[model samples]
Target: MTMKAKYQSVLDLGESLNIQNGSVTEENGVLKVKGTANTPYEKNILWDKIKEIGGESPSDILANITVADESVYHRHTVKSGETLGKIAKHYYGNAAKYQDIFKANSDILKNPDLIHPDQELIIPNL
Candidate 1:
């Protein structure tokens, strides 16, 4: 198996990630995630999801994946020729952080082998 896939599968065994569980009921323009508390993670994660899926129909990304506890992760658009090591050095200032990125964004990035342009990834600071 690839490194990214291995890391992601490992994380799946640890904790469950949160997503919009068809919990939001709207009449006109009101939207809300039912049975949820308001916290820093609530705001940041919501905004992040919206931004990543901008100007389009409902893709339901957060709905299908695990929800993280803290929203310390930042988003990165994959550029051609970009590698996990490069992303690690750019964000965490250490090459070792690539593994964290790989772990955080395994949904779309199933391996550290190669990332494509225009693909968005979540790079966790922690």
Candidate 2:
């Protein structure tokens, strides 16, 4: 199978993620993919898809994925009944880190208990 055909799923994923500056080429049984994901989570999604298709470390694929934003880990749009603790638990796997999220978004969040629907909160890097 050609490299391009072999890594077709990755290319499709890049498209689905709306990757910017995306380029794909295949040479000598190796596929090279380069793109910029809008967020770190989006980049992670690409990597996870690559690993899923290629195994732990696939030598046939060379992916250059980048995040467009570096300051915030994720920009979460708050939903009704969502608290800092819930958001912290979702991102960091620890509800206790709510304070960390609260502190990072102090400019927007006045209290840990007052997040409303549609509010954008910055999930700072830990």
Candidate 3:
């Protein structure tokens, strides 16, 4: 398969993420992908997808993913029945890190135990 076709899923993901200034091109046997992700989390996911398809250090693809926002790891919108622990676990793999999230969002979160849907919380860089 052509390198472009081989990495089509990565391109589709970039599109779904609404990556800015995205471009894709294939030269010879190598695929070139460039884009700006809104957050570090987005950029990391893109790289994860690339590695998943291409292996740890595949030479078949070259991705240049930049993050527009480095101040925070991600901006998470609270969902129903979701707690800070769950969000922390989703992002940091440790539910105990909920305190960190609560601290980062102290301006909006008065209590770590109390959170509502539709609240925008900053998942700070650990």
Candidate 4:
């Protein structure tokens, strides 16, 4: 499929990417510990069960989660032979969202089928 055609039917599986933990593992001291149990209790003992398994702070772990790109308000330069439907799929991942793209770029895109190369168009994330 052409790049523009491929972009005309865009979609993303909202899956979170897993990042391997950056914890050290090795033999240390007399016992040669492989990994730390890291039990931080409220009173000298680790209480958060979630941390014991994940070994990362909530915010730090959440930061690694993959998220779809969302545009608030923006502009896009039309490449050769591109259509608003294609642009809609490129940004919103659904050709049905072409109306959204048209509404967003109405200032420049007077016709849904009329787009010119190198022309600037507005893009609004919905």
TM-scores of the models, in the order given: 0.43, 0.81, 0.97, 0.42
> Considering lDDT, where higher is better, how would the candidates rank from best to worst?
3, 2, 1, 4
Model 3: weakest 10-residue lDDT segment is 3-12
Candidate number of the best TM-score? 3
Candidates in order: C-alpha RMSD to true structure: 14.4, 2.2, 0.7, 17.0
lDDT of 3 by residue, 1-126 (tens): 999888899999999999999999889899999989999999988898999999999899988889999999999999999999999999999999999999999999999999999999999998
lDDT of 1 by residue, 12-117 (tens): 3222433333243333332323332223334445444444443234332222233443465556788989899998897667987888888888888778877899
Candidate 4: C-alpha lDDT = 0.44
Off by over 4 Å in 2: 1-6
- TM match of model 4 to true structure: 0.42
In terms of lDDT, the best-performing candidate is 3
lDDT of 2 by residue, 13-120 (tens): 889979999999887888999999988877887888889989999999999988999788888999988888899998888999999989998998787888889988
Q: Model 4: per-residue lDDT, tens digit, 1-126?
A: 332222211111111111122122222211110112211111111212224433554321222121223333346689997888888777667888888878877776687888899987766646
lDDT of 3 at 27: 90
Tally clashing residue pairs in candidate 2.
0
| Model 4 root-mean-square deviation | 17.0
The regions of model 4 sitting more than 4 angstroms off are 1-73
- Give per-residue lDDT, candidate 2, residue 18: 93
Backbone clash pairs for candidate 1 read 17-66, 17-67, 18-67
Candidate 2 worst ten-residue window by lDDT: 38-47
- Using lDDT as the yardstick, the better of models 2 and 4 is 2
